[model samples]
Target: MAASKIAIYGAIGANVAIAVTKFVVAGITGSSAMLSEGIHSAVDTFNGVLLLVGIRLSQRPATAEHPFGHGKELYFWSLIVAVLIFGLGGGVSFYEGIQHIRHPEPMRDATWNYVVLGLAALFEGTSFFIALREFRREARGRPFWQALDQSKDPTTYTVLAEDSAALAGLGVAALGIWASHRFDMPALDGAASVVIGLLLAGVAVLLISQARGLLIGEGIRPETARAIRSLAMQQPSVQDVGRVLSMYIGANEVLAIVDVNFKDGTATGEAADAIAAIEQQVRARFPMIRRLFIEASEAPVDAAATA
Candidate 1:
């Protein structure tokens, strides 16, 4: 629903159009490089559609069955997208490129191929810039790779990955088309395709790593842990926290479980009610945390707590 999401849809829309055009041109030209590039773009279009669907479904409101919300599902779908990109786009392209390199073929009307590649590059460049703009906006005051690492916003991650891949693919297409045109050596085109395949594989690895972290319920940074510690001490019944554990359950949801030392010899019934109250307070203060459980701990005083 955000502006960046709309921009991603535009990128997706353009890719579908470009993929169709590229496929027709590649078939007409009988160029293996062009065919590989077409397949690459076609896969990209599919990836974009998958991202859009993931983004949409991930936004669904929480249900009774999934009281924590349906956020982790996004990570699962994103991981699947990554696998598809690597296997379908990268593997297929690598195989086709090797075949072309071994057995050269005559190409017809290289001009149209070059023209389409250039035009598609221009469009894809625009889309990449839009994604970059959003990335920069959200990643303000942080290193680029760090921002990419810490960004929990699904839309940013999905669109950023797709557009980055799309723009790079465009570059590869252009280089291959130009090389094949210049020397009339189809092998250069094939080599370019090999490079494109590697790029896709690299991007796939990135997506999968990030998605895997999310699926495993990785927690926020130590700073967030510190914030929670400070808030826990504010509860009058809680003397000090003993053991704390927290993991991110969604973009804005953390699953928090705490072991705290309440005042010694406090009334058992009162202590039970007090622990429940502390849990509610923690959840209220940190709306991002969906679940909180407080258990009593008998331990020595330690000012510092880790989550």
Candidate 2:
């Protein structure tokens, strides 16, 4: 139902079909690149399943032992998926490529390779477009790289990256197959596999970095923090707002803690009322902030200025 689910399901379905076809063709034609592509697809299939599991686990309600809920489960699983992509998908592909290079086999008729690759391109392209569409909708006109950098949802982007790499790898495999047969040199097939491996490794590294940041605790945007501080300062009973600390506890949920210094002569009841008003305003503007705590304090103006 969700956009992320749609992209991930589409990818899994396409990869399952393509992987099976690729392995069959690889066995028939002995193309190293085909086998590598099959391995890549298989890894993607498993990764999709893991992401779904993460989504389910992340929805669990908060418990006494884990007051923040299981929101971080998704980040943990996403990190695991990145590691698997690097180890099984990238490492195995590289090793297979090196072996193929070391022991070159006689080239066979590549007509079937062409057929399978063309079909794979079609399937991968369809999945890629689906993911790209969802990402664009989420970006809302933000530049691609900038939106991707600021994105908190991992499912949509992870699927997009995997599909992008699949499309690129298919192109490389096709080119390598064509060149090896045309030039009577089979080593090019192995070279293509190596390139695919490197591509997967690079994507895996980027995903790992993002997952690590989320799992540890990534905060809301600086602009959003500043806006919240301004809201607090607008309250008549408030002197200043200080140390507006915030972190994303889930893809669409944030936990924020704000330190506020009330007016010098404000009554306790009035300060409490102001705190309630500030919380209401912040939450109204930013529904993603599921949990907000405002602490009354006597903080320095300089400190209050820095959200």
Candidate 3:
């Protein structure tokens, strides 16, 4: 966990500095779009920092009071980052766009603006690609965002989402900056900023939804359910599987409650042995599973019964 956070911290530091430079350039040139991108980068810095804090706190060892540890703090803090992105980045960009429409200012030192914008674009691209490479090694089979969207681990997903968004934002900013200078239409820059704002807001909404699911103890993926059910049913002594309930207890880790039904003729102690054996098998197959609590039932418990 500590190792994971180091990279995020580096990214945050880079973004904060990049944002400062972006704002300085934007202010000198009076380019609304550059200003919007600058604000967006600042929000990125905050999000990255918050993600680090969340990931750090979540790694605390489980205690008697927090049997589940502080893992949920990652989700809570990541959600807060999302809210900040929306309220701060999105809100400011929208207002700037509206302001530009009513009383637009002529951009100055446009040549200098291009140089600064180009450097910022390169920095953003480097950061974005680094994030993609980080996840690429693990996300080969899964689509780019699919793993992130379905991930239960808050810290990991937040970092991935933030990186992806940063890359996209840079591209948007580049277009806005170029169009504003190319066509001598400064308003286009502000329009691009507005579009970037919408994109950031969309990402924020997505982050919040994922966090909400974790907070409310969303069920494990269907594939997880099937994996649990199929594996338990494979046990020789198991007659049936009653129900399998799984919840994410850490980033990509799950705790499962499994009900196993053995033959009615079997002794209770024997059934207990069967359940224990099945649990061991489950752990062997799914190492990411952190907890497995089995309920031995002689007769199978149906889905309705468990519900």
Q: Which of the numbered candidates is closest to the native, going by highest TM-score?
A: 2
What would the per-residue lDDT of candidate 2 be over residues 165-221, giving only the tens digit for each residue?
899999999998898889888999999889989989999999999999898888998
Clashes by residue pair, model 3: 153-251
Model 3 TM-score relative to the real fold: 0.89
Candidate 2 — worst ten consecutive residues by lDDT sum?
298-307
lDDT of each: 0.76, 0.89, 0.76
Write one digit per residue (lDDT tens) for candidate 3, span 242-283: 768877767756788988777655655556666777778789
Off by over 4 Å in 3: 140-146, 299-307
Model 1 regions lying over 4 Å from their true place = 1-4, 137-143, 234-237, 265-287, 293-307
lDDT of 3 at 106: 72
- The 10-residue segment of model 1 with minimum total lDDT is 298-307
Q: What's model 1's overall lDDT?
A: 0.76
TM-score of each: 0.82, 0.93, 0.89
Q: Which is the leading candidate under lDDT?
A: 2
Put down candidate 1 lDDT per residue, 1-307, tens digits, no spaces. 3755766677787778788888899889876667777787788778777767776777788899987777776677778888988998888888888888898776677889878888888877877778778778767679988887778766677777776776777678678868877898888778877887888889888888888888887886787677777777776767787656887766666788878787765556556666767777677766777778777785333333321
